[model samples]
Target chain A: MNQTSQPKLWLAQQANRFAPALFFIGLVLLWELICRVGKVPNYILPSPSAIITAFFNVEFSRWMIHLWATLRVALMGFVLSIMIAIPLSIGMMRSQLMNRILYPALIVIQSTPVVAVAPLIIVLLGTDDPSRVLITCLITFFPLVVSTTTGMLETPPEMIELSQSLRAPRYRETWQIRIPYAIPHIFSGLRVSITLAIIGAVVAEFVAAEEGLGYFIQFSTSFFKIPQAFAGLIFLSVISLLLFKSVQWIQAWFFPWSLPKKK
Target chain B: MDQAKNSAYVSMKGVGHQYAPQAPLVVKDIDLDIHRHEFVAVVGPSGCGKSTLLRMVSGLLIPSQGEVSVFNRPVTEPRDDVGIVFQKANLLPWLTVRKNVLFPLKHKYGSYSAADEKRANELLEMAGLTQFADKMPDELSGGMQQRVGIIRALLLNPDILLMDEPFSALDALTREQIGFDLLKIWREHPKTVLFITHSISEAVLLSDRILVMSKRPGTVLDLIEVDLPRPRSSKTINSPRFAELTDLIRGYIYEPDVPA
Candidate 1:
């Protein structure tokens, strides 16, 4: 009896996993039908089919160029933010003087609007990729710092005592115990910042850049190529989704223990 | 007297500690000597600084007033001679059981040799955790985790092992089982052990001598020696002497307001 039920249970679980995708497809079909039956103007509200056609009509090479430009800025900004934020957070956690001097300043900076500051940064650094990357980095930096520091502080008191009893050196304790314990929190920060990195890059492009998906959206809308503008928006969402999924995959790979075990 | 004085593995001289300079002393005027290759248990009421006394012996905390020494050396900092286990198993969640056992050894000695690996495997075998050695801490039961904690403390071959309520978290059956395993292990490889627990029965079962403490501003009330035969088992607790010693310790813990 158990053997017969096992495969049946497996089949149900697989279907349960795919139920969300099936509902998404049904929603898209309903949207397409509504657009066709209403005879809506393509410029006002393009159907999903029209958007797909617009996406394909653009030469793949040209589409990739814009996508690559946006991706490069976002990726560079994200990496740079991690590089700066982790060390700064670690320093702040380790020394009271550093924390007192920089922590409040960081909170004040974080509270200010990134869009308001982007133009000022562009004026200071030119309308080049450097300014765009800097804007993205600014937007992504705070969450990483906050999450990393919180994780470091949350290292269990018993673990600290254990390390002390072992007479572990300061650097070794930080590297081996505190940092690994903080990894799940750090990844949570990464998940939040990756999405913001994309938004930051786009906002930067809107303010100053001559290239990227953000520039494509601005140029398309100006010419009333509404379907093309929708296509660029779609590409942005696709890129964000892919990056989010990649972070989740890397988290699962590096910290398998954090994942829930299968029965 | 000279031989006993010379063999004192851990000596505490009027040790006292408080969190702040003006705060009431947590445990005061603690003078004790744990002899070499002896199992010593400390039992007391809750918040009686039983853990504080254990911490002082491990050199995790410097006493506010007096000194703690191990093997004739004054302990100003944590040393390689001491191993400590906290109330929780406190195993690193990221490491497998075998790796967690070898963690301190790797940190203290820089790296592990073939001999270290063999010793780790032998410990796992001895604990009957051989099959689960590669598993993570979360995969094991509470009893198993504490067993691993014990093994991790043992790996460095420290002269003194200090345990703070190590078995209090386990269910009664598992606690008894692990307590038996601990006694057997101690019989085979005897080291000076200072165990702290709230359970008077556990103190009676494990230690050569039980130090019962009074309520807060904790100080040793009585040091009762257990005259039970070596290699004690579950049947030993049913013996008349075990009951008398436990009752005697319990009286010190509960009847602190009344004069002796």
Candidate 2:
């Protein structure tokens, strides 16, 4: 009886996992039917089918060029933000002076909208790749710094005492005990920052860039090629989702102990 | 003077500590001595700075005034001669039980050797945790986790083992079980142990002497020597002498009319 129920339970679990994807497909089908039945002009709102066709019709090389451009800016900004944020957080955590001096400025920067600052950034850097990357960096930097700093500060008192009692050197304690303890929180920041990096790339491209899916959408929409604009939107969502999942995958691989164990 | 010199493996001379310079002392004028290979348990009411006293002995916290010395060396900072087990076990969640046991060795000896691995395995076997050596801390039950903690402390072969209420978080059955396991381990490999606990019965069952402490601005109220025989078991706790010692320690902890 247990053997028969085991496979049945596994099958039910698999179905449960796929339920959301089935619902999403059903929704898209309903959207396609509405677009057809209402006779909505394709320029106003292309159906899902039209968007897919437009996506495929675009020269694969052209799509690659735009996607590559956006991916480069987003990834560069994300990596730079991580590199800057982690060390800055460590410095901030280590020294009260550094924290007192920089933390208020960070909060001020976070409070000011990136949109308001993007135009200023473009003016300063004059509409170049540097300006675009900088804007993306500025947009994604806050969460990484805040989360990394919080994680470092919140290292368990017991763990700290344990390391101390071990007579662990200062650097060893920071690297082995504190940093490893902070990894989950750091990953949380990375997840948030990766999504924001994509948005930052798009926003920078919308305002200043001559390439990328954001520019593709803006240019296509202005030409009233609504299908192409919708295609670009779909591409952006897929890219963001892929980046987020990659972070999750890396987190799972590096910190498998954090995951629930199989019985 | 010769007897004091021979017996004092650890000595705290009027040690006091406060968080800030002007803050009231959490621990005050604590004078203590533990002889070589003696198992001493410190029991007190809540907020009585038993942990603070243990921290001073381990050199995790430097006392604001006076001195804590181990084997004639004044403890200015954490020394390699001491190992501490905290109340929560505090095993690095990312490390397996064996790696956690080897963590101190990685820092102390710079890197682990094959001999260290062999020793770790032996400690695991002694704790009955050899099967779970590769398992993450969360995989074990609470009692099992604290046993892993005990093995980890024993790994470095420190002269002094400072345990801060290591079994307080376990259920009563597991607590007694681990208590007996600790007794067996201590009997086999004797070290100067300074165990802090709120459980009088646990202190009675484990230690050669139990130091009872007063409430905050904590000081040693009384030191009661347990006349219990070596190789104690669960049955040791059921004895009349165990009851009498626990009752005496309880009186020291509960008597408020005594001046601080």
Candidate 3:
């Protein structure tokens, strides 16, 4: 018989949670040291500490403002995408004529580079929040529509039979059988869209906007505040991460039964 | 009420179907009459269009040639009076076991209330899944999931039950268990059942009559009456009479390859 296992082994395994942050800390320390030794000018290569100080001291309020602006636009675009996508997907599923007419146009919309089109949109719609939101919607809309339509159409034949035999109304079948079956795929598309939304907002801001993380980055570079520019980059990344995580959380919360439990 | 005592509840008149207009007909000249409270089993070899015929009767398919009438009304599309249990459990993975049972009721009633919840709980309890009500389909064993499917079908209190190979996926032990459960439900609620299967024992153990069908361009070859008493069990399987009937059905199914 082996001796009782030490509880410290379990504690050691739990310490894995901090590994990535620790690794990032170590890299930052090494980069700071290298920059100091190399006597790199702040304009050329600001140390990690300088970037952090700039982020905290000078840009905190502006960062919050810009982050909120981008998030608001992105959120509005995402909600609109969901509202429009679901019905369009359902319509496409109900009619092959609708699919034939709309699918090619959807392909064209998805394939068009959002970044290249942002300038054109800004010119057409003016440099307003709506234009930015439109660009965001453009970028994120197709995936949701395509995935949801595919999901609704691909409902298990047996489940369809089950619904049919119940004499379920067409609307009821669409709601209970078709939509619920499509949820997993719909969530997958939504996860992809969350990040695309952020990218879309940023690209639109890059083309035309007086406020937002994209504008902050643009202005910080003009003023030669390289560390503050990097700070803006950090803000954008954090926004992207939070958006992605929020979608994951939403998917998990609403569809607890559908999700595969993690080991 | 007395008229319902004798005539067929479901009558199929010259039903024929094909996958496409140009394709060879899969089910040709099928005429079946299932009386009220009767258990009819359609048995055939694979690809023999037995399942296709059931679909037509259930109104999942429209026959190219003939009419299907349930309770003397044309079955133009699916009706709520009929419940279907598919070969697989086919429960949506996203809904809990109880929710799956409540699915048909939701379509029937169109809203949720405390009453619906109570009924759902009752159905789950009846299915012996009281503890697993919140469990998703993927979390349950295959036999357990199939039980949930059965309960879901019964929740509607349909006038007829259509089953397409409902137990063919289960192991022998599980199949026997479900077969008995089905019989108990049938006894408790006398619905006209049209069950499709390939197993001779399954058809024998459950059906009032077994309709044996021949292969492609499928047609009913024979109708064998199962005069076995009610509440038949595994003990009944050991009886000489049960064995004789089972053997007779088996011989028909595996009849010496008709010199095709």
Candidate 4:
């Protein structure tokens, strides 16, 4: 605020911005040092440099095949869950009977761990894209439904009264007032779901898949190629990070007002 | 007084509402009449059911006993002729100022026409909010948002405007400014206004008559005619008679009705 305070404030902000990156780099250096000093073999734990070498060892076309396999299943499953979750949320909101019937069923499904059921799903639906997508959908579904419903129900009572006073149809209340109010909550759900979608794809590949980063990791570790598996894990994390950032970017591009801090 | 009661445009006779089936009433034995195009302000302490009274007239809530009628017909359901302004601006945050003003029409009819758009722009101009028409509700000051609220209420050309402590959310200076702004707008386009407030001076400053209500089981304690001259300004607030009327209403509020 004051002229004397400006430089100190700027320095504080700079420190805050670079603190995490510096910490991460320092951690990687420490790990690399420990491995070298201890004369640790590459199989037990791959050093950062070895992991980077392993990443380069894989053929470019092979990496793309695995990346596409994981991305396709994750995206399809993510899109499918959104289609089902949003409508189901609206239905539960609009109808007391539907809420009563579907609520307990949804709870039952959500509580059942997808990992526990993955083998059975692959057995029943076969080890194809369909079973894999279903697994991803199950992982991504609950947060979307819960957040969307909570947001719609949380519309201000006075706004609902305003709708009623206008004698507007009940559907308009849902479409105009309730849905827009729910956007921020829904986007938060999307951010969580996008990451979960990637996790879901990996989990599916762990059970039954020929190609994906998850499958690559499993295949590498089995062959005791620990550095290659580490490489696959790192790649998976990078993709998840990109997907999360893309969700945030979509919200900023389309519904800037829905972002709470933007205002 | 009898003739005025008989000719009242909106009247309540023995209106009462119970909290539960056999429980004590929230508001009881309320009898009042509002003439057409007159601004009536109701002031009462907290828990006096001032908002409940407004809701009953809006036909959003029903009275368990007696009746509320507007234009000589019973108010059994929310009417198209009445508009309500809530305590908060209650603007849909996603909509622009222009869209919010036209929300009632779009909400009721599913869409707005070119003519409705013209009316919205004109009203925004009148409220001196034309420049901010394209802006979101959160960008405006509290007072400016509430002015847009009043504009939204007036968009439908409703005959009765029920305002439930509309300026209560604003700071004192902004409240006074918006009160005068409301008066200016009311002069240009008059409607039967039932303004509710916690501020005694605000009631005195804005209304033709002030309805002082009792605490719990809220009944009308006094309906004092303002007797203040029209085109009221800070000069009117400075007048002695204004003090007397506010004092009269204050006396009714403070005089212990139930023995301790």
Q: Output the number of the DockQ-best candidate.
A: 4
**Order by TM-score, highest first:** 4, 1, 2, 3
How many clashing pairs in candidate 1? 0
Per-candidate iRMS values, in order, are 1.2, 1.5, 1.7, 0.6
Weakest ten-residue segment in model 2 chain B by summed lDDT: B251-260
- lDDT (10s digit) by residue, model 4, range B180-239: 999998888988999999889999999999888998989988898988999989889889
Ranking by lDDT: 4, 1, 2, 3
Docking class of 2: medium
- Candidate 1 lDDT over residue span A63-124, tens digit each: 99999999999999999999999999889988999999998899899999999999999999
Give the alpha carbon lDDT tens digit for every residue of A8-90 in model 4: 99999998999999899999999999989987899998899999999999999999999999999999999999999999999
What would the per-residue lDDT of candidate 2 be over residues A1-263, giving only the tens digit for each residue? 69989999999999899999989999999999999999888998899999999999999999999999899999999998998999999899889999999999999988999988898899999987888888889999999998888888899999888877877777787788778878888989999999999999999998888899999999999999999999999999999999999998998998876554678
Off by over 4 Å in 1: A1-15, A260-263, B1-7, B255-260
DockQ order of candidates, top first: 4, 1, 2, 3
Worst-scoring 10-residue span by lDDT in model 1 chain A:
A168-177
Better of 3 and 4 by DockQ: 4
Better of 1 and 3 by lDDT: 1
User: Between candidates 2 and 4, which one is better according to DockQ?
Assistant: 4
Report, in order, each candidate's fnat: 0.79, 0.84, 0.82, 0.79
C-alpha root-mean-square deviation, each candidate:
3.2, 3.4, 3.4, 2.8
After TM-score superposition, the amount by which residue A196's alpha carbon in candidate 3 deviates from its true location, in angstroms, is 1.1
Question: Candidate 4, after superposition: displacement of residue A135 in Å?
Answer: 0.9
Q: Candidate 4 chain A: minimum summed lDDT over ten consecutive residues — where?
A: A254-263
lDDT of candidate 3 over A1-263, digit per residue (tens): 33355566666766687788889999999989988999888889899988898899764677678888888889988988988899999988988899899999999988989899899998899989889999999999999998898889889888777767766678888998899888888988998998998888888888888888888888899999999998888878988998899888988888876566776
